[model samples]
Each structure stands twice: as structure tokens, then as C-alpha cells.
Target: MDALVLFAALFVSVAVGFALGRLSRRHLQSQYPKDYALNYYKGLSYLFNEQPDSAIDAFIGSLEVNSDTLETHLALGNMLRRRGEVTKAIKIHQNLLARPGLNTRQQHESQLELARDYIKSGLLDRAEALLLELVKISSAYKQAALEHLIEIYQDENEWDNAISAASQLDGKHYRPKSGLGLKQLQAHFACEQAQEDMAQRNFSKARTHLQEALGFDSDSARASLLFARLEIHQSRFREALDHLHKIPQQDADYLIEALDMICECYEKIGEPKALQKYLRSLLAEYPSNSLVIKIAERLRWLENDYVAADFIAEQLKQRPSIRTLNRLVELHLPHSEGRAKENLQLLKQLVDRVIEEKPSYCCNKCGFTGNSLHWLCPGCKTWGSVRPIRGVAGE
Candidate 1:
């Protein structure tokens, strides 16, 4: 089916070329070029012989690019690029740009296509130069050029440039179809920069970047997480708790990422009771396997194994989970004797294997599963989409 579509598109382009040549012949008082007619037949013969490359070359040779055939040429180049023939696409678009009679729009369009070819071929530096030029001189292509520039910067890990391009693209009127608005994209970029600063132990610089990230997107969970890390690094436990507490409100899907940090902050402040209160609050609002386990561990530490086991059993009635069940068995295993003890031991081992085999995190957008959380989903590259998996077998 794809081959047929390619053939049909090529045939239409050739037909259009033939029609244009006929029209030119009538106006110029000259016979239509015999070479054009011969090449058209040669292209058809190549197509019939299953020599698509030769067919494409012959079709391109037959077409005389002018105002009339410029769009056809551009369309052919774009099709070739999409077909993974980047080198041929580059030649076609380059040939168009080299023509002297092209108007500004045509020139910009050709430059944009050639830049795309460069990007596809991994020549990002060349693509960046052409896209930057287009962003400066071509109002029609400015947004498109900036979008491509952002992609290049992201691929190159140049987050500052990505943020700058995203800022230019984030007009009041613009909204992306991915539902990941430019403001959110900019926020992620800023968070990326903050991460770099934090790695270098530049706490002040990291804080400034996190502040800018939150300014771009007040609901950025990644920014909150980073801020918590920065504050904790400085031994500002209270400040860290403040940032960690904001995560559930900013994006509850990422609340798991802040849970350990919240516990550490409360511990550092010498407030186990406060930690217990906060965990209960979170469990009441957003119950999950992790919260259940955390609360049960606290119960065991403060009271007895019986209390933790009973708590897990009651919670299991409300929300059945393998993780809670496993914990329940572990709490009771020591108290059992003979067959009962052996049975609980076997059950625990089985549940442990099952839990280990299950993925802990999953991408909400693409269903990519892994054991670790990814702020940007590896499958879809969507920011904040990957989260701790929830349900019977996960947290």
C-alpha cells in the first residue's frame, strides 16, 4: 500500500510537470522539450521495472522547477525526507534554493525543508544555522523555525537555548497540540538547568533556576522536587518540607517522589509525630500501596507487629493490594508456628518474586514500564508522564 501511494504521488508530480510544459510551449512559441517527454517515459519504465530510485531520479530530471512547479518540487522533497531518503531530499531542496528567480516565500520554504533534511541526517549544526536565519528573516516561518530550533537544542542538551526558543514560541495565542504548553516546556527546561547547577553544588544558582521554573509554571512538580533536594542539601529541613509538601498539590502523580524526602525532613526536625500526622493526611486523601506500607512500618515501630498487621488487614479490605498483603504476612510470620509458619514463609517468598517481576513505574502517555521513575517518559518524551504504578501489584 505504501509503495502504491509513493507511485501515485510521483505520477501526479510528473503529470503536473507535463501539463506545465505544454502551457509554456503555447506561450513561448517553442516546442515542448523532447528531453522532458523522453524522461517522463523513462521514469514510467523504471517504475514498471521496480527501479524506484531510478524512477525518482528520472522524474526529478523531467520536472523544470519554476513558479508553477515549485510547490511540486517542495512536496517531492518533503515526501522523500519522510521516506528516509534525506540525502535526495537535501539535493532537491538545495536545488530549489539555488534557483535565482524564487520569491521570498519560496526561498524560505526551501530553506526550511533543507534544514529539516539536515536535522534528519544528524547535521544539527547546519540545521541550526539555517533555522536561525529563517527565524530572523522570515515572519511566515518564525514559529516553525523556533520549534525546530527547540528540538535541536533539546537533542543537543542545550537547555538554555531550548528555553529561549520556547520563550519566543510561547506567545499568548500559541497552544501546542501535545497539551504540553510552551510554559510547561520552559519550566522543564529551567528545571533541567537547575539539576545541572545542583550537580555542580551551586546551590544559589540552582535555587534561582528553580524559582524561574516555578515562575514559568506554578504547577511544575519537577521544580518542586528539585527545590526540595536543594533545600535538603543545605540542611534546611523546614524549607525542604515546604517544597515537598507542595508536590501533592502541584501534581499528585509525582507525590511518590517526595514521600521519602518528606519523611527525612520530618525526621531531621525531630518530629516523628508530625511525620505520622502528615502520612495519615496523605493516606486519607490519596491512598496507595507505598503510603500504606509507610504507615504500617511506623505503626510497627511505635506499637507492635500485631498493630501493623491489623492495620494492613483492614486497609486490604478497602483496597486489595499484593504489596500490603505481603507486608501483612511478614508482620505475622514470626508469631506463627509449624505448618502455619511454613505456609506464610512460602507465601511471602512467592509475593516477593511477583513484586520483583512487576514494573514499579509506567508512562501514562505511552505505557512504557520500568523499575525507576522518569520525569520525562523515555517512550513518549512527555514530561511528568511517568509515575509510580498503582493497583493490585504496585505502589
Candidate 2:
């Protein structure tokens, strides 16, 4: 943030100085206005000291509205917005817009700056109105205004508007709409729309949106997960199995997330034998501890405690884990007589206490760790960056 303020101050100074120099191109004023020059120096002093808010006030107070100074005010407003001083930025821009000497181009620039100020101040509706006008004008500001319109719509959950603005920026009407940088983002928006449909119990609409999401980005794990949920809702467990299986192929790192739901689908369809075979293949390939613990559970339930305990114990020798060790102790507890049972219980309690403090998921983007999965990392707002932890104490 401090860096941003410094850059903003530098940009404002350069832009103002250039615009005023252009105005003096003909008349060539020999001396600077004493008051204005002194205030400009004060601004430089404050900004250099890392007091950018004070610098913005000094610079803004020094400038007057005129054909020569329109760019200067715009630059000051932009700098204030960058410094996170939205109210002062708005006041400066609004006052500039109200002035009489600005040309059509200068007026549009002022509106654009004010729109950005509203955006910074969380006044989305005001920003939206100004940006829409700029878009309709189709001036040099059209591209920038349309981009901000998309941002406003995204924040307001207006997917249809976002898609429209994104398409325009993508050159869909003019060309193929391929190079605007939002194909993957559009997929997430479609997924968001699918989620909204699912919440309203509109399964058919949800399916349509999910299909659209996949069309936008075939590698979207959230789309696959939501599709699985939709299938599960309609009791199409076998169909759900197909979608859940695709997630690992799309992004292998997210395979751990699909495991539990995959198990449920097979269980729902009365395919425990087939499920075990599938899990075995996955475990052999991935060796994820979740899969290991899952296979041990089936062994304990279908065969005997000793078989399951021995299975986990053998796996632990190769790849030790607190989870597997805890399950191993639980399996041994049922069969052991008094003292052995007591010792196993104590060991289980200790392992439980240790595992309880471990986080389930961690973000590779920002190193944020938490106990539950987040499709969009809370720390960095990055999609698909968080995943289940994998180590001796996790998986």
C-alpha cells in the first residue's frame, strides 16, 4: 500500500507537470505562480516522507480548474484514489466535473475518474451508472469503462451483465471473442450460477449451467463437484460416479476431495466389491492416506479387526501417518485383553489429541491453512489453491 501511494504521488506530479507545460507551449510563462509553486513543493515534501494523504490534500488545494489544469485535477484525484483516500478523491473529481472550461474529452476523463472513486468507496450503483454512460459513448474510454463494468457486475453477483461486458471486451461482436482473458473466469461464473440454481432446487437449470461451465473450461473441478451433487440430489448415484471420477483426471491434485463422494456413490449403488477394487487401484497409484485408511475400514468391516489392523500397520511401516496409526490402535483395542486394551486406549487418546490440532487444508498460494476445504482460498482469493495436507501427520 505504501508503495502504491508513492507511485501515485510520482504519477500525479509528472502528469500535472506535463499537462501544464503543454498549456504554456505558446504563451511560455516565464515564472511559476508563487503560491502554486510553494504548495507543489509542500506536496513533494509530504509525499517523500511517506505522508501521501497530506500530500494529496496539499496538491489538490493548490490546483485551480482551467483548461490548463484539468489534467492536473484528474491526476490528483487518481492519486488520492490510489492512496485509499476515496472521499477526497471524489470531492476533487466532482468539483472538476462541475467546472466550465473542460472539453468533451476532459469531461469523459473526469466521469471515469469519479466512477473509479465510487468503486473505491463501495458505491457500486453510482460507479455502474457512470461506467455505462462511458460504454455507450464508445469513446477512447470505452474499453476501460467496460472492464470496470464487468468488475462491478462480478462484485454484485450479476453474472449475465459480467458475461455481456466480458464478451464485448473479448471482441465477440467484432470478432471471435478469444483474447480478453476471462474464459476460465466465465467458467467459475457459470459454476456460481449453477450453485444458485441448485440452492433453489432448480435441477434442470443447474444441469444446464454446469454443462455450460464445462464448455467454458473442461478442467473446472468445482463444476464437476457441483454436477456430482446435482446427480446425488436426483438419486442418480451411478451417473454421479462418472462425474466424480472425471475430477481426478482433470486435476490430479484435487483427487483427494472426490474420494469420499466416490465411496458414497458406490455404496449407494450396492457395489462394495467393485468399490474395493476401484479404491485398490487408486490407492496403488496415488497412495493417498485417505485411500489407505478407507481400504483398512472396508477390511475391518468386511473381514476382521486383525486383517485391517495388520493392513494399516504394514502401510505405516512404508509411510507413517497419525491417522493410520490411530485407526490401527482402534482396530487392536477390540481384541486385546485388559492391560493391552488399556494401553491401546491410552495410545489412541494421545494420537487423537495430536491429530486434533492439525489443519486439513492448506493454500499453496499464500500459505494459509485451515481445517476445511475452500474452493477459493480465503487468504488469497485464488481458486483451487487450497488442498488437503499430505504428510506423515496428514492426508
Clashes of each: 0, 0
Q: What is the C-alpha lDDT of each candidate?
A: 0.88, 0.80
Best by lDDT: 1
Candidate 2 Cα misplacement greater than 4 A, ranges: 1-58, 64-79, 95-110, 138-146, 171-181, 337-343
Model 2, residue pairs in steric clash = none
Q: Candidate 2: global Cα-lDDT?
A: 0.80
What are the per-residue Cα lDDT tens digits for candidate 1 across 131-194?
9999999999988899899889978889999988888884765655447878888999999999
Q: TM-score of every model? A: 0.92, 0.79
- Candidate 2 per-residue C-alpha lDDT over 1-395 given as tens digits, one digit per residue, 9 for 90 to 100: 76665646564664566457546753645554667656767877776777766776667656656777776677767866887878988988988888787788888989999999999999999999999999988577888898788778867879878778876674443222223236666787788899999899999999999999899888887889889989998999988998988887787667777887888999999989999999898887788788888999898888988889899989999998999888888888878989888898899999999999998889887899999887657786565678889898888
